[model samples]
Target: MKVGFATQDLKRVDAHFGWAKNIAVYEVTPEGHSFVEAFVFAGDLQEDGNEDKLQPKLDAIKDCAILYVAAIGGSGAARVVAQNIHPMKVNQPEEISGLLDKLQDVLKGSPPPWLRKVMGKGQERKFEFEEEV
Candidate 1:
């Protein structure tokens, strides 16, 4: 199966999926439960309010079975669902290893409603960041 993680710096899971400059996709083999191969999408930063920014990520979703993201907007979420790819909302953790561990279960199937609701809201992280500091 294939999985995609929305990330920034191509390493850490970023706070927001839309704000991620890149996405790392992995091909996981059921045999050993390991990532057999990987790919990266590196390109222009998504422009705020620019709907076109999601095209690449949407395109990437076509090849992956599941997508793990920090946060995603309503339209993006809808697009992902329409593409038949399961979307899993993952909180940005301090370590990627820990985050991956937590996601292991979620990757098994569809995400719960709470997560769906959050993604449907399309709330941008910039607002949350402003509230934090």
Candidate 2:
């Protein structure tokens, strides 16, 4: 599946979803992953609360299954979700390659339901949570 990452230095996932000047896309599978390409944001990176700044990004990652962002506005997340792309917010800045490896580990192991969904396990998963009867 394709994964999109928001990064500023082209190495770490430290860029905000709406202000990411450089977005790196990677193709990840159980075998491993590879760099696809970088999507440059030509618009103003300082602009905030504007969907126009994020449109190109959404378009660029239309085929992506997951998007890793340092931060995302509610509207931006909604847009991504509408496009069937799962959005993940990174708590801290980390190396993109390292994060990818972690995802690989999850893929190789017994991934949780959410991870499975992100990996495109199946459409419309049935969620079951234990509750007080």
Candidate 3:
């Protein structure tokens, strides 16, 4: 399975997805993962409003099973989801290594609370837990 990560600098994963300055795309194989190939392109998709600029990067990630991002706007989030690739939000670790370590846990078919709420619609209010004494 291939996995993509959006990082500010190709070197590390900071707290915020920071800026989209670079994207580190990795192709994971059964034997092991390949070296993370860095895509050095401008990350100014928001101001530019040019989705076309991202087409190539998105194409390179077409085969990826998941796209890990530190932060993504609603539109970009929707774009990734439309591609049928699972989007996982990471807390922006200090190191980029060992990122895939949590893949199994992340892919265990449990949606996050916010996602569940969104999917539940009004029913989400019914599932709210009461404060414990």
lDDT of 2 by residue, 1-133 (tens): 8999998888999988888888899989877999999988776777776667878889999888899999988999999999988898889998998989998888888988876766772356777999999
Candidate 1, residue 64: how far the Cα is off, in Å: 1.0
Best by lDDT: 2
* Model 1 / residue 60 / CA error / Å: 1.9
Q: Give the root-mean-square deviation of each candidate in angstroms.
A: 13.5, 5.4, 9.8
Window of ten residues with lowest summed lDDT in model 1: 29-38
- Candidate 3, residue 59: the lDDT equals 70
Instruction: Record all residue pairs in model 1 with backbone atoms less than 3 Å apart, i.e. clashing.
Output: none
Which order, best to worst by lDDT? 2, 1, 3
lDDT, candidate 3, 1-133, per-residue tens: 5667777666565412224666677755433456557766564645546667667667766666666777666766677777766777766454456765444344345757644433332232555788999
Off by over 4 Å in 3: 15-19, 29-31, 43-50, 104-133
Per-residue lDDT of model 1, residues 23-61, tens digit only: 777654322234433435455555677778788678765
